[model samples]
Target chain A: MKRRNLFIFAVLAALGSGPANAACSFSNEVPIKVLSAAFEAWKSVTDAMAECGNVQASLDQDFRLKQSAAFAANPALYQLGGVANNTIPQLLNEKRIRPLNDLVEKYGQHLKPNQLIKVGGDIVAIAMMVNTQEFAYRKDIFDELGLDVPKTYDQVFEAAEKIRQSGKVDYPLGGMTMSGWNMALEWLNVYASLAGDSFLNADGTPNFNNENGIKALELLKRASEYMDPEYLVSDSTFVQQQMQQGKIAMANIWASRAGAADNEAESKVVGKIYTAASPLAAEDARPVAMLFWDGIVIPRNISDEAAEAAFRVAMEGLDTEMVQAHNDDAVWLIEGYKPGRLAEGAVATASAQPSPISYPMTIEMGLIHSAIGNQISGFFTGAKSAEAALRAAEEEYGTAAREAGLLQ
Target chain B: MRFRTFAAFVAPSLLLMVLFIAAPLTSVFVQSFFVTQPQIQRVETERCTAGFLEQQCTTEIKNVPVLDENGAVVTTTRFVGLDNYRAVVRPDRAFAALSAWDWQALMSIDFWKALRFTLTFTLVTLPLVVGLGLAIALAVNNTMRSIRGPVIFVSLLPFIVTPVIGALSIRWLFVGDGILTRAMEAWSGTEIAMFAQGWTIELLMLFYRVWHVAPFAFVIFYAGLQTMNRETLEAAMVDGASRFERLRYVIVPHLMPLIVFVSLIHLMDAYRVFEEVVGFRSQAHVISLQWLTYDLLQPDDAGNRAVSRASASAMLTMIGIVILLVPLLRKSWRDHKGAR
Candidate 1:
């Protein structure tokens, strides 16, 4: 307890004295949620596919498997599978694709042009925070309560009411129950597309104050009536306990976290948790979802040959065909995220009806995110009127963007 | 020979520090001065491994947009200096960024508000931790042997909880329909907004920090009490010293060094309040210089001026800490006077 107050201060001082005003880029938030799940899936496949136990070696083996699969199945994919520094000039100018380009031309010279990599399902976006659908809801609960699977927000509230009255369970709908961060993303969809108010206005001041924002909040707050008594008391993972134990009927959960929702191995409702789009803003509103991203950009220090080898290896994994062949074929995601222009023509083909949503590389995405976390929790907690909460959110979010230097 | 031996022994650590820690730190500091960074050129080359490396050969850093054949932006990285700071302090500029078609912060409100809120949150939480710590110290100073064990262990619970879990837990309790919330509602017959309300957040942070530190204070104070001379207190009592008198003339004086020591320790711990703040998601945040400084030591993820200016901000915080902490240290030193 007798901390040498000044001595400790002096130690910090000495440690920091080496540099003047140097900022450390230590970021903790990697791709989380389904994005993280997708990453894990990718890692698992890569590991299983390893020839030498070394990551690079495994990557090499997997790359060959995927490349061969692509060439044999769809021979036209030639260079399309590798770095497109040609399209995303920044990839080259920023040197994000240089090493790969060099390596493919150099170290990869050993490979025959006619030779194709074998496909074992290596390349794909995995391990992420993608907002998919509910994991542990009973079809019986909806059927017994005479409720249909809600397509839009209008049906959502009706279902909420019916479920609350059914009282067959302590709380009818449960999943990702207590995460404000989770609720935030769901709310963002409404605030942007459903709420009359957009995240940003023509003037760019956060416009969560618009009537649509209040309407969105009010609509979301409607669910509060049926939420578990401890809905706000336990975290999403914790609340998953209630759902997995059959205490609650439904929950809006991440595809990744759902594994834990039912403890896959021991789950009574095994294969029961289903992935669905986030609930709509209103019974009639369009379905909107928050994108979860797990982007992989190689560092700039590796040699050209290695970088190219790594790039090719990575490209082998991104193959949709390879992903679909995985043991868990449904687990291979390719829905939300849109690749940079380099692969637009190719991605356009992949980005059809269902795809894994990732970061949009847009500024408003961050703002909408900020607004959601701030307000959604406010509604469920009943701390503010939905209108007041939305307005407060606008101010805070707008303030954050300003500080981040994105608004102007 | 001595110098040579010492130099030889220290060489590895110094070299490692320079390569891994010092070099990166220096680069970060130097990069802060650059308004624009040099760009690497891309040359078309053959493929090796037939198609392996792509992004590895390149980096993500860019200062200008790279246009495609048709002249559309393939990648756009622009240089906006001091603007990040100006925007952070200037609400109007911050607001403009908010207008981006996206909901993300372009340059404005989020960072400023987060920074402001973080600072305020840290400032308020520090005192509560120290005050409660003092009270806990007093209680444990007199606790029976049997009760002290359980009290200390329970009090230390917050420290044992990881920041992530603690943060999630705080979210749960602060979220809607939490047990604490419902209980308060039943008592007051009115809603108590702990998470959304700015003031309630500070109290939450205080509770977290105080809860975490109370055990440490209890142990130290109890030990200090055990070490106290009963003769002096008995003599004071025999001379008709009242409770307050003995406490003021003896106990308070005796506790001064320990208090300053504990206060300094608690204050430092309190200043580094990233956990409690992030835990509670307190709307009004006031991040400490320490947290800011620590983050600045890393790379800029946001690619904004604030993150870029982080080095300068970190240096500023370090300077400020030196200025503020030096005085408190001197005062503590005075308390330990005549030790030699």
Candidate 2:
């Protein structure tokens, strides 16, 4: 089987300008679980890894649940899996995935120093790509309206109001405030940047019901008014569709989804969409964005031999050859990744911001997110006041924290 | 049969029940009385960069039950009796809210919120499911024999569809700019966002529940209708009873047992609602007790689960089901006794 795969790989390499120095080879089989959206990128790596080893990729958007369940139920079922940045903290704390420091030193010669996911003093995962939410707008509409690129949330509102009054677009903005998880992340993005480093204080008590919390809630509610009437149901796809159909002029959406805006088949306003850094909440505030890394983790319960094979396959998949081949699909962390036409906006967005902080991966942050996801929508719908919403959020967070033993 | 033979014959089923049902139920009950929280320990390590003379140390908090030779946690689960129940029920908070007459705040607790929706969903959908099911059963029964088979098949289609799919299909029809949504907008000349608010979502969920579940009741009633006494129905007609009166007095009385059966089944099923919340993505506005338990069992950001809380929620839901089933069980028991 190994010889057959190597033969197939050599033929494919001959057919395409495959990696000339494809030296790594293995006989073991490795099964990978990853998000379906990143399948194209994974496909390149899997195919490349096939030359040396048997590699299988299981594509699922519910990778978090799958990874956790697989590790809990039967870790040997999979050898390698990917997890989002926000999910890393849980995976690390649970010790479901073993420390990759030894493996990295042994097998990751081509890996960059910055790509290592260090929790405490040990490397646990190696990030393949970076993803974050950023400002995306219709450049043509901005030019026609003579609107300057919005640098602050106030400017964004002004532009939205002008666009709304001009009747150029049905909705001036798009939002991903779908009631639960997405909305929670949206609140986190705005609050964490505007309010400061953390939602909890040093002692892990609830601390978001302050002036900053109220302001963030008010800003969210105000910004929501300019979005689709069904903003509460609007997720990334809905907002993307709104942009595609020319219903909205601008949005803060994931950089990973920016390429979809220019897909001519699904878009009416193709080439009109442009991406930039997220609008600031205050004059000197951090950009209202959260950086996320998509990385692979090998469960600790898997056989050492399997883990080694999985690590080797993963490294081969994330090598320079694979990155250059599928760089357009994501903002790659690998070396030799040149930003393509589709990635130009995300590149500009990332470079423009002062290195956005990752979404905090602590359990308290997750609980705080649950609070925001559950209660903050009340403020948006006028069911509760901003102050009341903030208070409710704090109350929920406190209860959850105490219950989870994160606080006294 | 001899007593020993009877016991031997029943032993397998009893053993199976003890292993599968009784054991898990007992475990969940036991788990409800306990709570599991992260076990943390602080460790100090000295750092000497150049020499031992200039040494510094730092202390860090670690999640551990007991540290191994390599400082890895060997065990993390810690048991706290009754704390899981306390956390979910929050007796102190509930009392505070009640004493203060803060009804809104009282409903803010997750358990209370989920319980409110679960009860509302079950109670509201119960009668509608029964009535609609009976109505459809009668309509199909009255149809000509040639079309009866096809009519019954069409009536069964809703129940035949997967529950999640059925709920999702209904949800999409009413969600933003869906076909029905657009039609409503056009007819009313006003935009509608059916999923934006809790009440609207609840109404939609109730409607979906009826649409999806009524067929089961209908099939049962229709089968019962076939076994109705023809002579009694004819006698009722000859005695000048109207169609409504015949249905009310004769048919309903005859089908009371089947109606009870359907009600018992619906109560048990509806009280444990989970799929609809997920299908409609309505957790933002509405949640059910089963969903709450499932949500608790979900891995936190640290990969560990709220197992004790989930177990407590399961126990509470089971108790609710048992409470709802008591009267029906009592009625059946009385019927059995009277029949004997």
The residue-by-residue lDDT of candidate 1 on B85-147, one tens digit each, is 442245564567567643333212334434544456445655665566666766766788789
Chain A fold similarity by TM-score, each prediction: 0.61, 0.89
For model 2 chain A, the run of ten residues with the poorest summed lDDT = A29-38
Each candidate's iRMS in angstroms?
12.6, 8.8
DockQ for the candidates, in order? 0.07, 0.24
True contacts kept of each: 0.02, 0.22
Q: Which stretches of candidate 1 lie over 4 Å from their true place?
A: A1-40, A51-95, A98-136, A174-184, A191-218, A228-242, A255-268, A271-279, A282-285, A290-408, B1-204, B218-231, B242-244, B279-305, B308-340
Q: A1-408, model 2: which lDDT tens digit per residue?
A: 768666655654653434533545555445443332245555565566655534445666666666755675454467777776677666666567888888998999777776776655667777777777778888988999899989889999999999999898888999888987788888888886786556777676777788888888888889888987678878888888888999999998887777787787899988888777788888877778766667787888877877887788788778887777677778887888887655655555555545445665555667777777778876776656777777877877776666666667
Give one digit per residue, the lDDT tens place, for model 2 in B117-200: 999999999999999999999999898999998899998989889999988898889987789999999999997888877888
Candidate that would win on DockQ: 2
Task: Provide the global lDDT of candidate 1 against the true structure.
Answer: 0.47
Q: For candidate 1, write residues A1-408 as lDDT tens digits.
A: 235434433443443222211221121111110011223444543322221111221223123223322322221122222211111222323223222334434433433331221111111111211223332356667767776766556666677778878777767666343434456655564554464324566555776666777776665555655665444434566655666666777765544445554356655665454444455555444444433323233334434343444444443444443344432322333322332221221222123233222222333444455455644564564444566566657655664454443444
Candidate 2 docking classification: acceptable
Q: Say what the RMSD of model 1 is.
A: 14.2
